[model samples]
Target: MRILIIHQYLWSHYKGKIYSELQKIVNTHKNDELLVLQTSLNEITRANLGPVDRSIHQYNYQVLVDDYYENIPNTTRAKKMLYWVRKFKPDVVNISGYYEPAMNTVLFYCRLVGIKVIISVDSTEEDKPNIWWKEAIKRFVVNRAQGFFCYGSKAAEYMLKFGAKPHQILLENNAVDNQKIASIYKEAYQTRETEKAKYGLRPFNFIYTGRLMAIKNVANLLIAFAKLKPQNWGLVILGDGAEGENLRKYVADEQLEGVTFIEGQAWYNVPKFMALGDVFVLPSYSEPWGLVVNEAMVGGMPVIVSNKCGSSHDLVKNGENGYTFNPYDTDELAAIMKKFVDDPDLIKSFGAVSQSIIKKYSPEQVAQEMYDGFKKVMYEHK
Candidate 1:
């Protein structure tokens, strides 16, 4: 099988990991070939998420465009994507998204060439408002594809509403480099005290490592943390964004104690800072799939994820691995945070469950699932 994957960027660390796993799958199959084409150098989405390490690395198969990441005004993108598709003549094409004009053009080309397409979706109904035109467009385009790949069942469910069949839906479940992230956190855990002291973190800290934007609900987290008034525990907010100063100001005006803000580091260096915390929390009001939760789980730290996150459906086992709460309710968020602080023993137990639950969501597993879907789609489409 000749497989070609179209993705928005190569700069993302987690996506890079997924590519590596896919390469391994190709290597295992004697006649299989895999190639990935990256549309942009870097996109605004990544640029806003703080510092990123854009250093390139060797992969078995990858092609990157010279142009930087921008959605509009890329007049040549359709021509370039069609050129590659014709040259590669892949048996299976997996496009990473549905909304990109470039991808839409490529999908049409694939139809003309008789190549099976597997559309990837990372959205749930909650991610955006339902629009009739968009739904009609998706229903038309999605039905043309032979298979669908997504972050989890929520995304698959969304595809079902778009007229995709149950058998056509494949889970490439969002994942990270479990072993690598776990190893980094393990090494950091040994000297967590020194690390925490260096960052002025408390002995027991709850960490949130993403942009400080409004949709992320960082302000709600602050409100919840403040409600815990005068506790020995601390809250570390990592990453910088438009709401950075506003969040800092809110923390100050509320006189919230032991709340420290660390500017975001590169994806690889996140574990170094994350190891200083005993628990991880993501309070996003809306999230398709939170990959950070997977990182936290692999690092052997329990998570407090908002129920709004898609990963909570798979990675979190309410009261087992971590707790899931309503992001809208500050009181509910505070109660979960207090549980972690009041009983430190739950950290170790819950952390163990986190590691266990995360093992099944590894990049290798996703690669295998993707390969299976490819075979199934090819056979059915034939």
Candidate 2:
């Protein structure tokens, strides 16, 4: 089978891991070919995260239009996609996002050529504002897809609203390099205190690693942390965005103690910071799938995820791996934070559960699911 995948960027480390694994799986099958089309070199919005390692073409089956800007969609995208489609003549085409005009064009062309179409869905209803015309167009486009793949149950549920049958939706949940990250975290865990001393971090650190955006509800996290006011516990906020300075100001104005702000670094260096923390918290008001939760779990840190996050449905088991709280409830978040401080033993126990649960979510497993989805679309479906 010749499969073509169209994605926005290969800049993400998590995406790199999944795609690399997929390529490995494809190599094992006789005459199976996989080609990934990267539309953009890097994202404009996340430029602060530093330069993307363009040397990520570990697979020989990728085509990157380094000149294109993914944020801006126009007729040129249709031309570019059709160009690749004609050249590749793939048996199946997997599109990255539903909203992109380029992906929609590829979907249309694939239908014309009797090529099976698969869409990678991550947008839950909470991720986007509900607009009738938007939903109508989305429904129309989604109904045309023969196969649906997504991050979790919530994402699969979102597909149902867009006209996909339950069987047509396959849960290709997000993953990180669990084995690699776990190894790195083990090293970091051994020397955690020495590292914490260098950075002036507390003995017990609760980490949040994402953009400092309003949607992330980080201000509420700060409020929750302030409520605890534990002398030995600290909150580490990693990543920078429009909300960075505002968050710094709030931390200063409130005189919040033991809240540390670290500038965002490259994807490879993230585990270094994750290793210094005892627990991870993602209190986003709206999130499709928080990959950081997957990373933290692989690193053996208990997570406090928002119910609003799509990953929480799968990655978090209340009081097992970690707790899931309402992002809107500051007091609830504070109470969960207090649990880690009050009982340090919970960190090791909860983190163990996190490690156990995270093992099921991996790039190899996602590739197998995706391959099965493609085969289903090709030969099984009537």
Candidate 3:
């Protein structure tokens, strides 16, 4: 079997790890082959994360454009993608998204050629408001696919609402490289004391790592932190974005001490910062799938994520691993944050559960699930 994946960009370190693992799995099979065609090297929105090192991408892949994804012309992307599809003659085509005109064109061509399509879906129904016309179009496009590789239950449920069958839902786990992150966290843990002193972090730090965008609700996190006003507890906001200056001003205006704002680090270097925090928090009002939560869980840090996040449904076990609160309710978020501050012991206990829960969402496991989905689509669906 030959599998071809059309991805928007080659910038995701998490996806690169999964693709590399999937490639290794494909190689083990005598006649199986896999190839990924990425539209561009990176997306303009992700430029703050810095250049993606090409050396880490170990899978068989071709970059269709050297520019950012948004800058790539649709016609050029469609032509290059079609050229690769025709040349490869793949048995299965997995499209990363449906919104792009180029991806839609490729999907149409694949359907017309009788080649099975497996849509890789990360969007949940709650990610955005549903307009009737847009939902209708989504239904039309979704029904054309033979299979789906969903990021989580929320994504699978969203696809089901759009007329995809349960059986067609193939791979459900969206993951990062757990072993790599855990290993990095372990090494960083060795120098934890030095790093903590270097960064001037407090004894107990609640860390949020990601772009400081409006949707991330970092201001709400600040408000929650202010409500506590604990001397020993710190709030670490890592990553720079459009709202960086505004958040800093708000923090200064409120005179919120023990709050540290660090610029974004490279993907590989993020876990090093993760070692400084006791618990991880993602208070996003809208997040499809928070892979940062996965990284935190792998690093054995309990997470306080918004219920709106897709990962909260799959990864968070409520009070077990960590609590999920409504992003809109600052009081609810504040109460949850106080849980860690009041009883410091809950951090270690909850973090232990986080590690155990995250074990199943490893790159190796997700790659095997994807390989199984490819086989099922190629054989059973036929």
Candidate 4:
């Protein structure tokens, strides 16, 4: 099946879950080109970091775009897309948005020409559009899409407020590349021990990989780490964001001597980091869905995420695979982290369970669900 995807903000450093998953499936399918018509903005959401004006494929580019419609906000981008449509003649048109200004109009026009749409949603309570206009973009445009794929049930709940039917919504998780990353870690560990030892991290380390933003509540993590620093379990902060300086100040003020904040590293280095961590924690105040949760699960570490995170609903099974703590309660995070480190038996059992649970979130499974939904949509709408 020929599929044309409309995902604005394609990054050079790392591709988003949908595009990466689709590419993997398309490669296997052989007949599919998966014509991707994406646009990206040169905007920065972080407070730090000077601009790097290289080609589209340089630096750890910010994947988040402030202008949902990518600044074009007019017919120009839509008109240009038609040119691609004529050449590709995609059987499926997956608009990676719903509430952006010109996005719905573009999808409606595609339908006028006979392409079926499978619009994916990026909605989250933490990242919802401003309450103004009563969320018209979602209520009017999203409800009518052929199919809606999202992170999970939390997204389905939000889409329902927008008048979308439950059946039309399929859960598409922001998952980790299980096979690729794990193999890299395995190879890296077999060759190098000095690299990890240089950072004061021993074999039994705990890691956190993500942006250092306010909502992420890495400060909460530092507090939790303070409770467990006596146990010899080192803490590593992986990604960088606006809250970096504030977090550093807080760490110093708290006198968290053992906690180490390593700025954003290469995305490919994730497995190696994950290998270092005996347990993983994401103490987000209100994360819609964290991709790092998937990484931790696949890497054989017992994960601890906030109940506020959307993915925690599916990913964490409490004592079975991992723990989901209330974000407001630092004590809960501390308890889980201590358990992960103190009891190796529990870690092994939970890690095994996490590995089994990760199968449901694979890219191939999600892509097939998307393809089947597209065919069903065509059968009904045609």
Candidate 5:
């Protein structure tokens, strides 16, 4: 099938778990005459932590599009997309996000051509949708697209409120490669054991992996860590961003000795580091569904994620598998960390529960669920 995948905020330097699976399919099907057009360089394009590999087409989408500042806020994006539609004449035009200036522009093109448009949004929050224009545009294009795909059930409900029909919203839960992780866990854990001894492993190591943007609440993490000086916990901040440098400076100024901040590592290396952690935490301001949560869970590390992260709503069993805390409340985050520190048996017990739950998150299984979503949308559209 000829597909035209459009993601305006898709940067070539960015590496996501979705990229690994999609690229495998793209590489296998490149001979099938597939075209994946992508656009990027949104708000947090700085601190590009992409790999420097020359051989791998890590960021190369099947097709490429540019978004300049001058072109934004103008109708030029709509005109360009219309031209692309006519020239490419694809069977499917899948869009990643329906937010920002790109949302209405893509909606207009999809309406004009009567072509299939599939939207995959993170989620909408009751506190703040951020992109209020997106809600209005979604209602306007209620039946314009084939269907809408949400990361979690809560997000699906929110999308329906924006005028997506009951049958139109599908759940494509974010997952990780459990089989791949299982294959390498034994070896990686052994390697990490030796590596940790050499690097001087600290007790109760708390690791956070993801973008260090404002939404991640890295500052809140620092505040919580500061409260745990007498405790055994040490914060290991992984991933890079604009807030990364500032955060490093803040750590030094605050004289945070227990914290060790490593620059962001590549996507493939993340799982290994997660294996070394005693506990993993993600205090996202409002993440649709952080895929890294599954990565950590598969790595057998208990996670303390914010309630805003869409995955936390489903992946976290609230004290059974892992803990959940409010992003805005550092005290709550600190308390969760303290629980893990105070009890070593909790790690072994909860870690077992976490890993058992991760078995179902295999890539093969997730791919089937995603394919089901695709078929459902296509059949309903017909």
Candidate 6:
């Protein structure tokens, strides 16, 4: 069997890890082959994370464009994609998104050629406002695909709303490199005290790692943090974006102390900073899938994510692993944050549950599921 995966960019270390594992699995099969076609090296919004590190992306892959993905012309992308699709003649083609006009072309071509198409779905219903025409168009595009690889339960549900059958749902566990992150966290955990001292972080901290955009609800996180009475806890906001200066000013104006802002680091290096905090929080009004929550869970840290995040549906076990609150409610968010401040023991207890729950979403596990999905699609198509 020959499987071709068309991904948007090579910057996602999590996808790289999944592809690497899938390649190994395919290699074990006598005549199985896998090829990944990346659209670009990175996206413009993530240029600050630096170029793609080849060391982390060790798999059979090709980049169609060396420039940022947003800058790539639709014609060029479609032409290149068709060129590769025709040359490789894959038994199955898995596309990362259907919203791209180029992908729509490829989907039609693959369908005409009798090649099974699998779509990778990450968009949840809550991520954006729904429009009648847009949803109708999406249904048209979604119905053309033979199978789907969903990010989580929410994503699978979204696909169902667009006409994808339950049996057609192939893989749903979207994940990061659990072993890699666990290793990094273990190393960081050893010198946790020393690292905190180096950065002057509080004994206990609630960390938010992502772009400081309005949709991320960073301002709301700050407001919630401000509500916390003076304690040994602090709010560590990592990553930089347009809202950085304004957020910093808000902190100054409110006289909010113990709030440290660190510029975003490379994807791999994010786990190292995760060591500085005891709890992880993501207050995003709109998030398709919060992979950072996976990173945090793998690092054995309790997570307080917004209910709006896709990951919260599958990963967060309500009071067991951590809590999920509405992003728009500052009081609810603050109340959850105060739980950690009022009782630090919840951090370790909840974090342990998080680690156990995350084991099901490891890269290796997801890769096997993807491989199984490929075989199932091929068999049904035959």
Most accurate candidate by lDDT: 3
Where in model 3 is the C-alpha error above 4 Å?
none
Estimate, for each residue in 1-382, the C-alpha lDDT of model 3 and write its tens digit.
9999999999988899999999999999999999999889999889978788777689999999999998989999999999999999999999986677888898999999999999999999999999999999999999989999999999999999999999999988989989889999999999998988898989999999999899999999999999999989999999989999999999999989999999999888999999999999999999999999999999999999999999999999988999999999999999999988999999989999999999999999999999999999999988
1-382 per-residue lDDT for model 1 (tens digits): 9998888776777777777777887788899888888777677756744443444233454445655567535457777778889888999999977887889888888989799899989988778787999989878998888899889878888899989988888774888888889888888889888877887877788999998788999999989988887467899999988899999998788777899999977787889888988899999989999999999999889999998888888788989989999999999999999988889999999999999989899888887888888889888668
How many clashing pairs per prediction, in order? 0, 0, 0, 0, 3, 0
Shift of residue 50 alpha carbon in model 3, Å = 2.6
Those runs of model 5 whose alpha carbons end farther than 4 Å from true positions after fitting are: 9-35, 40-47, 52-61, 66-84, 100-103, 126-134, 176-186, 249-254
Residue 166 shift from truth in candidate 6, angstroms = 0.6
Which of the two, 1 or 3, has more lDDT?
3
Q: Rank the candidates by lDDT, best first.
A: 3, 6, 2, 1, 4, 5
Query: What does candidate 5's lDDT look like per residue over 1-382, in tens digits?
Result: 4555665544332223344455555456444233455443332343254533333334345323345333354355555555666778866676766654555567657667676677776765643655767566656665566777676777777777867787777655666556555556656787876766655667668889887888789999899988877456677888887698889889889888778767776655776777667788899888878878887888777888899888888788888888988899999998888887878678878888888886776655554454455557545666
In model 5, the Cα lDDT at residue 237 comes to 83
Q: For model 4, how does the per-residue alpha-carbon lDDT over 1-382 read when each residue is reduced to its tens digit?
A: 7777766655422334445555666677677666666555433442223232234232122222344334554566666666666777878787767755556776877768877777777566555345757587557777567778787767777777777777777655655566766677677666446767777765566788888888888888888888877556678888898799998898888877767778776566767766766678888888777777877787766888888888888888998988888888888888888886677677778888888898788765776677667656756656
Could you list the CA RMSD of all candidates, in the order they appear?
1.8, 1.6, 0.9, 4.8, 4.2, 1.0
Residue 374's C-alpha lDDT in candidate 5?
55
| Residue-level error in angstroms, candidate 1, position 275 | 0.5
User: What's the TM-score of each model vs. the native?
Assistant: 0.95, 0.96, 0.99, 0.83, 0.81, 0.98
Name the 10 consecutive residues with the lowest summed lDDT in model 5. Answer: 9-18
Error of 3 at 123 (Å): 0.3
Per-residue lDDT of model 2, residues 206-285, tens digit only: 99998988999999999999999999899999998889999999999998989999989777678888988899999999
Q: Name the lDDT value of residue 188 in candidate 3.
A: 95
lDDT of each: 0.85, 0.85, 0.93, 0.70, 0.68, 0.92
Minimum summed lDDT over a 10-residue window in model 4 is located at 56-65
Q: In model 3, what are the clashing residue pairs, if there are any?
A: none
- Model 1 CA lDDT for position 347: 93
